[model samples]
Target: MIDVKQPPYSAVGDGVTDDTQAIQNAINAAQAGEVIMLSSGKYLCGPLVGRSDRPLLLTGTVGAQIIAKPNTRTLLTIRCSASNVFQLEFVGAALTSVQPFLASSCIRVNDGLSGVVIQECKVSQFSGAAIIANASISLRVMNCDMSTGQLCVQAARARNIVLERNTFHDLGQSGFALHGDGIIIRDNVCYRAGPVGGFGAVQAGSKNILITGNHSTDGGGGFELQNENALSATEPSGSSCVVAGNSFTRTFAAGIDLFRSGVVLTGNVFNDCNFAAGLPTAFTVQPGIVPDLAGPGSGYQAGDILTLGGGVFTRPARFVLNAPSPNGGLCDPARPATNGNTYVIDMGDYSVFPTNPANVTGGHGTGGKVIYTNANIKARGSGYKSGDVLRGSTGTSRFPVLVRVNIIDANGAVLEAEILFGGYYTGTLPTEMAFAAYDTVSSGSGFTLLPCFGNRYAMQYSKPSMASGGSILGIGNRNVIVSGNSIVNHSPSHDCGILFVNFLNAPVSRWAITGNVFGTFSKGAIKRYNFGTLSYDTAWGAG
Candidate 1:
């Protein structure tokens, strides 16, 4: 059975809530399943020593912060044989401890153990790692933030561990790392780590692992998977690993570095890679997300529609559809129903013909607004030009629409004006908000550019539908599609337009890049390469 109770000793500071006695009481009295809750306040105690054989927990008042003095060998040592939990905050002693001897770490999970969980705590500013799970223990650390320490979390020869929803920022070395099995890391945010000493975001060697939904920014390119220092026994180890839906932006090394076998890489975006530009393919691997493009009444049709998650799309034209039957072994059966293909061409622009949905509500539609007309005086301009400003019915004036220019004269003279939509004044020939810059003008057709070796353009908009600072969708285990997002106005120091990399050689196959804007990129946009099985749909600017 599980035990839950409070600590015995309770001591408060004079005019200061002294929690030293309270902590000792809790630790001494805690039974196998009891919890020792620390009151909210500063506990000016010396090093907290854990009682052997007593499964204990040192927690704090929800809002209460705790700090211990320095010179203590270990802060809240764990010698329990059974499963134990240490939640809240526990720090080393300071102030009263000799100078140059402040404190080492906030906590330590010591000696052979199993089923240990350390969660929801803020541990940092220590000389060593925030928490060190010494050799031979299985641990689960979830929803915690570790920063400013030599190392955030380190486990030597651990197993069955999971680290999820945690944040590691501004550290000297790796974020969270372990040597174990059944490890899964998801939805965590790591930034500005490594480059101080020799550090990577995550470095681990585990079997049957799943690392998904995480974002690593700046510093190192992202993750590294290595064989543990211990010699192998040839025991069918470190196989079946899946890494997906993670974003690595402005990284120095490759987005993900793999050193072993049987891993899969899909739907992970890498933007503005520094140390390792594009993907570096190595080892036995597979690319999980690839597009199956069969055309014109063939591949994916109306009935083939799937649910679409939100994200940025660089190319906006090439849509993926299914072809006629006999299509058995072509597509991966594990493809999720939520995948959709993206293309360039402003297919939603009304100037071409019938109006598409302007603002779709409910029933899963593009939740963004599209505004373009024949003229501003009549409604809105259907055309575009450089420097065109848009004046809405409401008193707000918008851009790229208001800066329209009429025919370029022989002498390079450009005529500028505020135009209306639909109808024009007599002999005035009112221009639309949209206008293609190059000389080629084709009526009834949206702007199309002949393929040029290297071309560049600029656009401005409010914001993208995806979250400002997070990954939108994850691609895992082969066969996927990323489509339809109008990305714009990206700030510097930001990486990615649409990223593709495979850690397990699950080389992304048959990918279709469509319908997304790449606005103001200091680095070149749409970076793609491979790390695993050499197969995938490789198309850039697919309009």
Candidate 2:
């Protein structure tokens, strides 16, 4: 161990003098497994590069300061094996610049390095990331205070990296973002990670990542695990990730926004997420969907239901499948939709049925489902669980259909369903053409009108839409689980808390839910489609 102040180099840390060459000389003379120490006072310098074979260890006294000048890339570059940097307070040269490019990070562990440990370091006023690990392994960054950078830590294509007990405040981007494998961001605190947009405070797009025991406040949102399947190429699809024991408060939108599948999000807390416009839930289990809306054929509008039996029905519903499919996250459309076989598909609310069943227009016997009217939902407004069967009244298509009650928003609106098809589109033989009911029904027919003659609330609320109405909807998704969190809205705007819908008429299963609470939403707490097992582990709704 050689001290820079004691060597023949005799470096000065007067907080003003240029100490760049003095420190570089010590690093050059030191042998493998050597230590270079910087005593109290600021050493103003440019980039300090580390060695490969020597495995250098750089330490500073309690008040030692490294005021780094600006460079195109990082101020401290470590392209070596087993390099450790600790106890150094790095302030950008621009902040306090003996040097210019204050645009990069304090330290950058480059590719092909292993076993790097950086602890107890404080960095401020850099334009880019505080610490970045690219193609490095076993990189442990603990007990660091990083602020005012593009990103606190950006780790890409790395393995076995652990970031613990770090405080990232007011960062321009995410606190910790990873695009690699085996990364764990635990026991960290982030405040206002992304001041704008719906980005996550801790965003991951890799495999085997665990984000546990972290606390976030007033950020873009919390942990978002995504599998981005773009049109041209596919990025790394996150799989087998776990987010547990995390707490989030006052996020702009969601607390934990999930865009991938096969994740276990357990024992987390969330509050005040003004869920994006119509979609709800601080934690959403929404699968991505895409429309081939180009070239010769135009895309379908909101209520255009195309059935396999060469028929198209449009019964407008507030249906929006907001998640765009990842590169490989789509299954083939409703199969066996062969030509010449007539079919009628129903895209209605998940729980409440329509008010009239006799409204189905064109009924051909050898074909598919018969579109029911608001009358059908009016009769079954009590509620329907997933897989429960429902029968139309004698006046209408007296078919037995199965259904499931998937979603119930805060407004007490239920989805309309037939019992036999298990909440799916059913086909009945062509019998009667009830075109008048399908084409001439009045708007908001699904809502059960409240006879509030005085009209204390808004006119919209007096007539609450329910069953097969505009306010309630479902997109055909099968298996999903949104459990164990308090998804609420404290904002004065009355936004929804959780909104999960499916556009593709599909079936899913294997759901797990438990220990959850919800309340204080502007509109409603939960808005979902009747797709999977709707089980409640704990009591929810405004407590």
* Best prediction by TM-score: 2
Q: Estimate each model's TM-score.
A: 0.48, 0.57
State the lDDT of candidate 1 residue by residue for 1-543, as single tens digits. 211123235455332555555666667766766766645555566556677776656565564455655455455666665544444655433322001112266667776777677778876545457777866456878888776334677776667767878888755445766666666788888875643211242333566677889988765437765433211111235356667777777554445644333455566665543322221211000001122221111223322322222222231112122321233211222221111122111222112221211221222222222111111112222344433322211111111111123322243333322221111011212122223332334221132111101000000100111111112112222233344433333346333444444324244345444544454443334534333343332563222
Name model 2 segments beyond 4 Å from true: 95-102, 197-205, 228-239, 275-481, 492-494, 501-511, 529-543
- Top-lDDT candidate index: 2
Q: Predict model 2's lDDT versus the native.
A: 0.49
Q: Candidate 1, overall lDDT?
A: 0.42
| CA error at residue 358 for candidate 1, angstroms | 66
**What is candidate 2's lDDT per residue for 1-543, written digit by digit as tens?**
878877687888876777888898888888887899988888887888887667769999899888875453567888787999989988764421111112467888878789999999998766567888888899999999887435677778788889999898655446766777787888998875542222342333577778889888765456655544211112255445777888887654356644444556677777654322232211100000112111112222223333222122233221122221121111111211101111122233223332211122121211112112222233223322322322222122211111223333343334532111101011232221111112122221122211101111111111122111111111232233556766555554544455443323442234355566766554446554332343221222222
For each candidate, C-alpha RMSD in Å? 24.1, 22.1
